[model samples]
Target: MTLQKKVIWITGASSGIGEALAYEFNKKGAHLILSARRIEELERVKENCSDSEESVKILPLDLAETHGMNDKVLEALAYFGHVDMLINNGGISQRSYAVDTQMSTVRRVMEVNFFGTVALTKALLPTFIEQKSGHVVVISSVMGKFGTKFRSTYAASKHALHGYFDSLRQEVYDHNIDVTLVCPGYIKTDVTINALTGSGEKYNKMSKGHKNAMPPDEFAKKLIPKLAARKEEIYLGGAELMGVYLKRFVPKLFNKILKRVSVT
Candidate 1:
């Protein structure tokens, strides 16, 4: 379905893919509810949109705080009286080995990346059910489908999203609710820089692969059309896309390849 005039709520709107998507959806004439922890940054993103004042609304949200999500959802719904789409894009990444990573760090990752998204989706479900039509788009990762070095906890969080959303899709099928899981491989963004190290400190450095990855705007441009087509899942990236296929079709080889790749 077209995004024209649709009230689309996007998390992580301060930067990266979420920020780029705001511009793309704005170009499609969609009314936007831009959300992130940084209200000032969210406003900056909104101001950059085509018709900032009329089409965009900033809703600062901290996804890690699950207790407040229901209230956030209610406030979001009040924006346009209904939300046509909800983009589950708010999450954190990891850049540490499982052996060295602390349990608290792992829990923080899961809390923000998995439970937070689930909580918000649950809060919005009643509205979508009443409306009888809504799209739930999740920005998962290639790691969700397979294990990789230095991303054990982060990968686990994403994998959890796949399992939960896959089940939700089946349960909501008859309700006219659609779930699209977008597994993005490496894309040029601050994800790596902000990734948590084993000690839970920011990695603070971009990886070589991310430096050469697809630009977020370019990824967003390609994503919108697929989303409009209502695809259940789509992978967007460069050579990393091969890993998703290899893991499914040639597990042994994929395992070997993962071991040799200089993931960082």
Candidate 2:
């Protein structure tokens, strides 16, 4: 149940929450596989790990590319024979209204955030079931639970994840596989700056809320124990967590409040 000695694979490990989690998990003595599009950044993260030479590994992957992911799963298994956990953290965000967004742009975001994540998980499912032990950790956003302005595609992708994984969780429960659906609020990441616009270009600007949002490192610190406990669904953030409740209990009021809140 502890992270120590467990083989944990984290996608999007080059920066932000993924990078911070790499450091935190290394400190906890987990054998790590860090994957991302950038090899150099993965190398940098590995270099920073505790006893990294003996425990950490780097596997470059692009979530948007699914043809090679089954092979990537094999390659990941080759590292430690089996993976105890797969952190489905790799994804893209959008920052445009539906009316202004391109269909191609929306598909691209969905391809990365939903299809890519599902491809990897479905690829890894047999291994987990065979071993009778594994964890699927998804780093969804608060937008998954509730929609916001300028996040049409982003919210859709996240909502899709909740539906898919919630079903997957039930199906896998008997196989001793667990799923953790994490809805993270505004963590101080480059997500906003890296978010896609209507034309599929980067937004390149930080949101006002993200200016004082939770730090990724601090978030990583809080998340490890919850994962160890096998919590089914978790919402991690500050005041923004309230939106999840508001939307659920007082839909009319939440929609009115959502309009006034500046998401960008």
Candidate 3:
């Protein structure tokens, strides 16, 4: 469907895939509410977009601050009176082995990635139900589809999103609300650099796979069409997407491959 005049709220719009989505959606004449913890960066993203002064609204938000979710939703709705779509893209990653990871570290990741995202979505659900029309997009990872080394908490967080949104999709179907889970494989972003370590420190290193992954712009370009289609779920990536199918149809072989995979 055409997104002209569509009002979309995108979290994590300060960088990476979220930044790219902001530009692409703006090009389609969609009004945007750009959110992230960094207000300056959100302003930078807004300024860089076409017709952004009127088309984009910068709203600073920290995903971990779940208690303030209702206020944020109110502010977002105040920006445009209504929201046609909400993109939950702000999340953290893990780069350390689970055994070495502290419980606090795991809790932090879950707080930001899973609980925070769901909180925002829940906060906005009432509006959609009232309107009887809306779309929700969650930018999950291929890691959500299957487990791998050194990213246990991260994977669990993503997996929880898949389960939650899947059930939400079904429940909201009658309300005409679409829930889409986008499983992205390696995209060349700073995810690895900012990933959490065992002790909750930034990993500060790029991985071999990310070194040769798709660019954020291309990924966003490919994503809009899928979003317009209102797909229940879509996996975006190169060969890494094959793992989703392998895990589904060949569990034994998938497990063997996972042990040897270069997840770093």
Candidate 4:
């Protein structure tokens, strides 16, 4: 269960939670495959690791390009010849209303957030089955459990992840492959800044909620323990955690509260 000596491959490693996880796992003496679309940023993150040159390998990847994911998985395995864990963290966000959002934008969001992650996981399944031991960690969101204003498509994409991975968990349990779904609430990251607008343009602005959210490093520190414990699902955040429980136990009340919640 310990991350020590484990070969962990992390997507979206260039910044935010993914970058923090790389540092945390590096501290635990885990060999890391850091991947993101920006190779330069990935290298920068790798350089900051404890033993950058020895323990980290930067693999530039664009999760939206699902067609190339199998090849990318091959390249990832080439580094250590095997991988103990795969973290699906690369995804986009939305900052527009459902009615105004373009269909192309919805497809793009789903492509990167849902399809891309699914494709990569499928590519790596054979290896996990062969090894008879591997872990899959998905970085989903609180929105996956419930919809909120300005996040219809983004929430849908996350909801799809929950459905897909939940099923995959059951199917892979006998294979000794564990699946963990991490639903992180508001965290201080560039997700809002990079979120797509109705017209498919970057929002390019950070929200007050995001500005005051938990730091990515702090969130990562708390998450590693849960991951090591092989928890099926864990929610990391402040009061937002309550929404998941409320939705399950008090659907009517939760729906009323959701309407008044300022998710932006």
Error of 2 at 56 (Å): 0.7
Tens-digit lDDT track for model 1 on 1-264?
777889999999999999999999999999999999998899889888888887899899998899998899889988888999999999999999899999999999999999999999999999999999999999999989987899999999999999999999999999899999999999999999999998899999999999989999999999999998989999999988898889999999989887888998
List runs of model 1 lying over 4 Å from the truth: none
- Per-residue CA lDDT of candidate 4, range 42-142, in tens? 98898899878878998899888889988988999899899999999999999999999999999999999999999999999999999999999999999
lDDT of 1 at 257: 80
Local accuracy of candidate 3 as per-residue lDDT tens digits, 1-264: 999989999999999999999999999999999999999899889889888778899989999999999999999999889999999999999989878999999999999999999999999999999999999999999988998999999999999999999989989999999999999999999999999999999999999999899999999999999999999898898898999999999999999998887788
Off by over 4 Å in 2: none
Residue 11 C-alpha lDDT in model 2: 96
Cα-based lDDT at residue 40, candidate 2:
97
| TM-score of decoy 2 | 0.99
Q: Which window of ten consecutive residues has the lowest lDDT sum in model 1?
A: 46-55
- Candidate 1 clash pair list: none
Give the Cα lDDT of each candidate: 0.94, 0.93, 0.94, 0.93
- What lDDT is reached at residue 99 by model 4? 93
